[model samples]
Target chain A: MDQILTNALGELLTPMTAAYALAAIGLAMHFGFTGLLNFGQAAYMLVGAYAFAMSTLAGLGLIPAILISFAASIVLSFILGIPTLRLRSDYLAIVTIAAAEIMRFIVSTTGLNDVTGGPQGLSGFARDFYAINPFPAGEYGFWAWTMDEKGLWVRVVAWSLVIIAALFVAKMIRSPWGRVIKGIREDEDAVRSLGKNVYSYKMQSLIIGGMLGTLAGIVFVLPRAVQPGNFGTGLTFFIWTILLLGGAATVLGPIIGSMIFWVLLSLTDGLLSAGVDSGVITFITQNQIGGIRFMLVGLGLMLLVIFRPQGIFGNKKELYFNG
Target chain B: MANEIAKGKAEPGCAKVDPILVADNVVRQFGGLTAVDVKHVEIPRGQITALIGPNGAGKTTFFNLLTGFDKPNSGNWVFNGKELAGVPSFKVARLGMVRTFQLTKALSLLTVMENMRLGYQNQKGENPLAAMFRSVWKKQEQVITETANELLVRFKLDAKKDDFAASLSGGQRKLLEMARALMTKPTMIMLDEPMAGVNPALTQSLLDHIKDLKKEGMTVLFVEHDMHMVRHISDWVIVMAEGKIVAEGPPKEVMKNPAVIDAYLGAHHDSDLGSKKKAGK
Candidate 1:
């Protein structure tokens, strides 16, 4: 039991976990607050990573690179939103997913190999970020877990960014601006009559959320390398799962949901692998358990949607108008 | 640019108090039907004008057309003397005109106060770049809250400030919509069926609030069903039937007009007959 707890804690505290939480926060802003079904969070993250990486390679400092990445994400959001945002909700969802897939294909094309590394991925570029680590040269740990100086630094900076972003989101939702987003989510026509440009507000929401998603992408690849495979449709699905696991519209829901989701996955994987090795589950092999875990999780999610569509922290009223 | 020139020429003066809104030869065609065919109408500034008609009389459709929620097949609308024929809904709103919905389009998930805040125009944090600065947003938040509180208190909805809009009673939702419309500090406010589904206790208060809108120098255009409320509050009443304006005058005078009685009350008589027959079975 303690071993499982230790492993879960280790997984939750990883920089990757913070990155997922941050991206999920952005997703929550898009889908939860504004009720925009953005199934293309991964595309924003990818653009952010590529833009930052390319700018860094061009000798731009960290701040300038980050700014450039944000600008790139905003431009991409506009391109996706212009024709699609004016359409129906379901159409927007379809366009966003296709756009994400298109982005992945473009990055994987051999013609862009020099820039995107043709799926071999980009590394050594993050060394500039690591060079400024404030941690001393030693391993840090609690109980049977530990992290080296670089790992500790990544976790600290990643979580700090997440916290700052979360605070910014928290404040915006409470302000008049947040109200407009919620207004659009409810009845855009009514909002329009109020002399509010519903499309403009929606575009703003998409850009802000996309920028955050891109920031998450940078954090995602910072601790290790930027791999094209990591920014796929699966990443977007995982973010949806995180947003739903917590209350979608609640401020802290995504952060807590991300923690719970990782912990549960780790626990399930550990238990299922143990079962397979002990021959208690003779119907499945250790390698096949990977697929089985996801299936089992899928079942759990189905049950959650059936019984409590609003998830643990979500208010049922928030789910009343699904746009 | 044409709209700007048109607006400059129509500036309010002693020669004529330029109507804040003009719907001329507006027609909305829904497939094989003309939902609204308003030949000519004017909503003067700082006056309360009521739009009353029977159900399916195309009152809502006319509101939609004038506000840019739905495009008219052929028509032109001017707000504050500016032609708003092709202007989108949001830009129209930003031009000092705001409206509410008949179905009470209060954002269900947001709290009552939050709904009021959403009505403010040109929000700073709405810009993605302005989001990073906490102090700037915080200042705006305070202003929104203070103003929301004042509006809530006036609407007698202060106690429900923290509750989600979904929790409000039907009449309360109506109040919330009116209160929220004021958040824009609009020069003109249009409401779709402000009294529909409202409790009797709130009926008088809702009328008073609509009256208060004019008291505060805002022009009010509303679609209503209740003849009594319209007569009680409205300075002018425009009546529509079969998608066209059948009558327009002071509320008391329009109600007595033969065309209004025939187009509106005559239609109600038929519906009432059908309903009575069904009940007989």
Candidate 2:
């Protein structure tokens, strides 16, 4: 039991948590601040991951590969934003979800096997990144928290990016530009009447949020291989859960929210598997634990929304904005 | 009163003596229905002009077209000597013309001060890159804030500047919307039903604000249902019915026009509804 508890707490240092938190911040920019309903954040992550992996595989240096990923993020944002930005917000939600699925299928198809590695996915692209790992080649920390130099590097880089992103977002939200986006969120016509180019502001927000999502995608795959299955619609929804669990509009909400979410998920998975392995649980097999933990999360989400729609860190004053 | 306002005898589609806005053959249709079909209309410069019509008279639709909030099927309008037919609403506003909505859009989630600040344009801090550097826009933001504070006090919304717009009363929202529109310091202001849904206590203050705009030499064109408010504030009145201008003149003359009276009341307006069968035309 003590070991299980330590294992669950250990998830706090995983790069995956930082990745989700970064993407959640991006979603907050889109939905919370700008009132843009982009439901295809996973598509952005996929694009970023693919761009980085493919570019790196083609002998491009790490800087150029990352730049290519950023460029891809902008292209994807425009592809999604142009047609739907003029319409009501709901159209964006529909287009994004569909576009994300389409991208996943494209990357997963056997036709793109040589380029995207098809279902097997690309690997060894992080060689340059790991080669530059400043940590000495040795085990770091103790117990469940212990990891090698590469693991330490990945976590360090990922968390640093997440912290920088959260701070950047918090600062931007208080600026004059933030005012325009927030006004657009409430009423686009009102902002337009004030001589603001609402469409341009919306597009800018889409690009910035997409960039954040792209960075998150890059971080998400740094410690592991980039898989086509990982960027499914479920990924987008999971990131959304993290955002709402933290606070949709607040800066620190996504960071803390992601931490709590991963810890809870890990804790539940640990406890359930322990129960099954020790023969204390009779009904469910080990295979069912993964699905059961998500069910618990769903119930927790429902309860959170019902009891506190403003979220844990969400301001009560901004409650009506959510409604 | 009508002679000074119009070049000749006041009538439907009459020309203003000193026109600020001129539209020729402006028409808009929604599927089978024609919403607005103005042949020629000129809004007088620096005066309070009221656009009055009953429900479904296309007054709001016309306002939408003039403000570039909606597209017209045909016809072109010029504001301040620039062709503004295909211009977007934001560009139209930047050209010194601004409008308010019939339904108040007070940006409820934002503080009243933030809403007011949004009304100002061309802030360097509004640029994303420039926003990262405080030295570029901090002083300007402070100036904008002070100006917003003064506007809030003038509108009697100083006490509520820190409060979210959602917390305001309906009448206060209306005031906030108007005050926010003024952040642009527009030369021409179009108000769509500014008095609608407002409390009677605030109505007088709203009226004084409109009158104050005229005193500052700003052009005001407003759509309204209240005849008393129109008569009390407007210098020129243009009446519409069934998507066509029916009368144009001073308030007293326009109010007395049989066409205007018939548009507001029925054609057989003299007949009483209580004794409708006996008084049938």
Using lDDT, give the best candidate's number.
2
Model 2 over residues A1-323: C-alpha lDDT tens digits?
99888888898889999999999999999998999999999998998899999998999999999999999999999999999999999999999999999999999999999999999999999999999999999999888789999999999999999999988888888999999999999999999999999999999999999999999999999888989999999999999999999888888888888989999999999999999999999899999999999999899999999989888999977776532
Which residue runs of candidate 1 sit more than 4 Å off their true CA positions?
Answer: A1-5, A57-61, A134-137, A306-308, A315-323, B1-18, B121-146, B265-281
Structure candidate 2, residue pairs in collision: none
Weakest 10 consecutive residues of candidate 1 chain B by summed lDDT: B7-16
Candidate 2 docking DockQ: 0.73
Per-residue error at A53 for model 2, in Å? 0.7
Model 1, A34-79: lDDT tens per residue?
A: 8899999999999888888888877888999999999999899999
| Per-model CA lDDT versus the true structure | 0.82, 0.93
Candidate 1 structure quality by residue, lDDT tens digits, B121-238:
7777666567566676778778878998999999999999998888888899999998988998889898888988998999988888888888989989999888888889987777
